[model samples]
Target chain A: MNDNPFSLWVYLSQSPLLWLTVTLVTYAATDAVSLKTRRHPLANPVLHSLWIIGLFLLLTNTSYTTYFAGAQFVHFLLGPATVALAVPLYENRTRVAAAVLPMLVALAVGSLTAIVSVVLLARAFGLPREIILSLAPKSVTAGVAMGVSESLHADPSLTAVSVILTGIMGAIIVTPLMNFAGITDFRGRGFAAGIAAHGIGTARAFQVDEVAGVFAGIAMSLNALVTSLLVPLAVTYLLR
Target chain B: MLEQIARVLLWLSLGEIAAKSGLWPLPAPVTGLILLYAELAIRGRLPDDLGILADRLLQFLGMLFVPAGVGVIAYLDVFKTEATPILAAVIGGTAITLFVTMVVVNRLGRTIAISREPGSERVEGAARDVNA
Candidate 1:
């Protein structure tokens, strides 16, 4: 009769299921709290879950590689989720079409501003060139941002980290910041979040409102396309 | 539910094909989204099952990013080294971009609303009659 707590932990750590279960359970618990709190910025499920899971790993002395081995399943779902964004865009087609020109102009300006500002700021901060280049596509989705970083000879891992941070920060601050600025239009809110934060921001937008979600999805995808094309050009001519 | 998932996967597969073939520089999911939207636009209506499935998936969209977000733990060393500058650039840059984008889009949206008000009012009135 081995009643040792550490024995159970050892057994669980060897199995891939532990991380999978941990990730889902942690997220579910935090998500419930988020909903109960009306999705307060401080109660953000992603941030909360990340902290919880990271702490768990640290406590267990589990390496990220091993944890990701099982947790990758949840990460894999991001692709299908991104595809599902089309449903809302289609559902709101009429409204989207009505604001097409404004969305386009905003997209162009927003994407350029995100890239230029990050690059300049990183340079001004005396960061390395690779870091600056990595920060250039910080507002795009992780996949696209990593690609842009690789092309620019920057660290993809750093880009991924920056991209996630940008999303989380944008999600947390965009609403309150916009409220402070007296901006209340769902489209404007969504567009700003999507263009500045990418997928994470889009996720936050969806949490706020369906209309905001749809526009955020649109802005997320559009920023991905625009940033990928523009960053390389900017890196070559502007950064050089 | 299975059928709806299959349909969604089918669109996602097409997107992957476009991405792998270099026909689209955008990610597979983004292309998938565009493909799905195009199909729905052509069909002129969303099937109920797919609609339900999409809603369910989108509802938990934030959860999907948690795994990657947790990767922050691995980079704690990087943060420890250059935390100040990185935080400053990321936070400051994002705030600026958010502010500028919101203002531009909000102004643009207002302009569009005013310019199209007359035509849109008629369209809305006709839509109301249809609903009635």
Candidate 2:
């Protein structure tokens, strides 16, 4: 029973509790920062949380594998959260039914454009096949994007990061970009944000306007479906 | 709460079985999403507990990605080597997707005159009433 500070840390870090507590605590702090700024898109809690945790690991010489041993609890929720999207979709069924035509068009065009543009740009810039494959699903929600990456045999971790980055970019730029384009339709605006950025963009839409948020929710779910299917087909064709 | 958790897990389990069996090309969670949605559509009303459960979990949805996103640290070398291309693809591709999708959809809405058409009410004011 040689109980010293270093021995305690070695013991604590080996257990899942330490990293799990760190993950949650870091998120709560970063989330407060995001809230403090009135939910500013640039102040994304996930982005802040990741870098903070990442840096902590770097300084401490902790491997991601060890950190993930505890943080997987949070990651596991992504599956149930994906399923939970049904609640919003069910609640707004009437609105979805009304604008079926435009939603359908947006889904098709937006989903294709997201996949194609990423692949082509990545390829043109001479990114390797694996990176391009991972980038293929960057526009989808993180969970679904990771699944797509796994199916394509690309790096799911890389895909997850790309998806987050894309979401942050979409959330930050959606309002200003839409305003500059002189588009006032919340439906189209929300749909574009959801399709282009996924859940983070939808969160931004919810902050700005309820109607936009609902439409963004709808678009996010629908685009998740469309992008998952399209990514496989598009990758095979484009990369072949 | 226990019942709601069980319900979600039940659907998720079935989704996993389906995915593992290669019966669906979609991810397990996605298949679960569809199954849950179809069940709700058939039932024609959201279960109170289920809705509550969803809201509770989804409120902090952003936090869930932290674990995976931190995996980026392991790939610092990848980012350093290909930062330019990767950033260009993500930022540029997103902008183009947003611009193209919004412009096209907005133009379609205007040309269709969805707002003026009676009983449609797909525009701003009517959207509130529907949600309300």
Candidate 3:
């Protein structure tokens, strides 16, 4: 199998564009399906695209490094995309200003809960110290979470995986869970999603409503800042 | 469009420089967002060109995360070994955070709403137009 010179898989795997195109096309198709299904939580395009891409890599025996070579182009946009969150935040400035106090309080408590719960639970399960440290910033965006993990001498790749799973879990269940809890306020819903899930959750909030999206953006940014500062200190103090 | 993107990239670069300089313990993108927000605040509105580009990028923001999210494949071994703790922490922790944050924010929002009026009603109407 490794010596198959004529194999299409080998050729495609060699091409950097393969993973890039696969990512974009799979996301577009999954997004369409999500729309057709009226954006049902289970029809989440990110989840679908992730599974599809993961399976593609597995079936082809393509290394993640190879896939990421092309996919980095898309990954590069995350920085700018995160900065672009300011547009919505600025657009909703008045509401943000009015709710600043509550947002700050929520950010404080939410950030704490996200960090503490993961650490406590991970410890209770007797996970390794590095794993617990990686889980500390799981609710932050991948880039920031990775940075935090690295600074804590934890595994960045593990942190990235934890962050994605945290986001997916929050995106899939937060809204319904909030609704059951009688929380219909877009601001609250969006804030909670951002605090719990970070970027993916903020994206999900955007899909639900603009106001929610705006607050989600704000929460995501604030959570990143708060988590980066607090996670290291908390890990040293509590875990040690 | 090119110019607008360049301007946004400039801000992002500035943010990266600032973060790298170690002046603030924040992510470059976040610092960039804060800089952008400050610019908007001082300018009173987003420049038409930049707003268009930013809106376009943000409209499909989820797509930007697909690449990184797919990195999960790299950690399949970790997942296989630590699946229970990882899943328990992520799922249970996120649920708890979501529930607690929503409850706290909802309560606080109600307190503010008593005096502020339901701004979301008007915002929802405007949001419909933009979303449409």
Docking quality tier of model 3: medium
The DockQ of predicted model 2 stands at 0.49
Give the poorly placed runs of model 3, Cα more than 4 Å off: A1-12, B122-132
Model 1 misplaced stretches (Cα beyond 4 Å):
A1-7, B114-132
Which pairs, if any, clash in model 2? none
Per-residue alpha-carbon lDDT of model 3 for A154-233, expressed as tens digits? 99888888899998888899767865776667888899999999989988898888888898999999999899899988
Residues B1-132, candidate 3: write the lDDT tens digits: 787688678889998998899876778888888888788889897788787877778777888888888888667687688898789988999999999898889889878852585666665355333321
Model 3: per-residue Cα lDDT at residue A127: 92
TM-score of model 1's chain A, to 2 decimals? 0.95
DockQ ranking, best first: 3, 2, 1
**Model 1 C-alpha lDDT per residue in residues A1-240, reported as the tens digit of each score:** 369988988887877899999998998898899888777887778888888999988988998888888889988888888888888898877778878988999999999899888888988999988788888899999989999899888988888889988988999999788878877677788889999999889888888878788989999999999999999998777677
Query: Judged by lDDT relative to the true structure, which candidate is superior, 1 or 2?
Result: 1
Give the alpha carbon lDDT tens digit for every residue of A1-240 in model 2: 565888888888888999999999998898788777767667777778878898999988899899999999988998887788778778867666667787788789999999999999999999999999999999988878988899999998789779988987898888778867767777788889989998888767765665577678777877888898899999999999
Which residue pairs overlap in candidate 3's backbone? none
In candidate 2, position A131 carries an lDDT of 95
True contacts kept of each: 0.67, 0.64, 0.70
